[model samples]
Target: MRRGRAKSIPKSQTRRPAEAAGEVARLRQELQEARALLRELAEGGGSVVAKRLASLEEERQIARGQAVEAAMAKSKAEGELRRLQAAIDKAPGFQGWLLRRARRRLETG
Candidate 1:
């Protein structure tokens, strides 16, 4: 039998009490946001709500599509934004900004 060495985690992967708490807070905030969205969507039971839900679903499916496509204007940020936006429609104009802001919080905390 052959044995291999276990992988070691980097310092960034280390969990601290503050970090854990912050993560919990963030997750709770996310859950609240999701609940709010559900409530908003459920408020009206008509073609409008159904159309919005269908649009959101279509965005989700497009995001899941796997293909090798050329980048436009050689803009890498656009690609990343589209990928993240497709997955998260709430932050359409602020996807990249929000991601960077969250990273900053993690680094500062």
Candidate 2:
């Protein structure tokens, strides 16, 4: 096999001790700032998620209340319909037939 030429080193790699020390200090400061920024982002994201969760919970509660009100209204209307139907069934003859015809027309409409 043929021998390859030796690799050349960059001047920065042969830095004096003081210069290397300064570079290390600067890198450490940058690392601290990056860590602080990451923490702030994480806290901000958590707060946004928490606020969204609370909003959803409030909406769920409002929907539940509306559902309950709708159920109550449906129950009251059904009771009234049953009472009216019973009255129609008790009606004598032609009047009952007329009422039934009207009810059928309303239902079809």
Candidate 3:
């Protein structure tokens, strides 16, 4: 049997929590900015209540657009995750080994 040396993989092959956290932080900042802009638009001077209502409606439309963009971004991230997972699952002699290590780390700490 040719059960000799196994290849060692680099740590960068797997996704890290830090990257995910950074992405979340960045998205939060964007959402905060969008909200601030909407608030500004809604609070700006208007001659009539109808005008204010229209401005608020515009703000709502902006919020809806932001929500749709966020949804698309989430879908893209999920697709990327699925691609990575599929790649991991197809690797030889590594799927179960990696899963066990992940489970052990999660369970222990």
Best by TM-score: 2
lDDT of 1 at 44: 62
Q: What lDDT tens digits, residue by residue, belong to model 3 across residues 12-90?
A: 8855899989989999999999998777768863445678789999999999999999999999999998886676556
What's the residue-level lDDT of 74 in candidate 3? 100
TM-score of 1: 0.34
Better of 1 and 2 by lDDT: 2
Among these predictions, the greatest lDDT belongs to: 2
Per-model TM-score, in order, reads 0.34, 0.51, 0.45
* Top-down TM-score ranking: 2, 3, 1
- Model 1 C-alpha lDDT per residue in residues 1-109, reported as the tens digit of each score: 8789978999798999998999999999999999988787687647667898899999887766522233443477788867865655345567656866776687699
- lDDT winner between candidates 2 and 3: 2
Clashing pairs for model 1 are none
Decreasing lDDT order of the candidates: 2, 3, 1
Residue ranges of candidate 1 with Cα displaced over 4 Å = 45-109
RMSD of each: 23.5, 15.8, 27.0
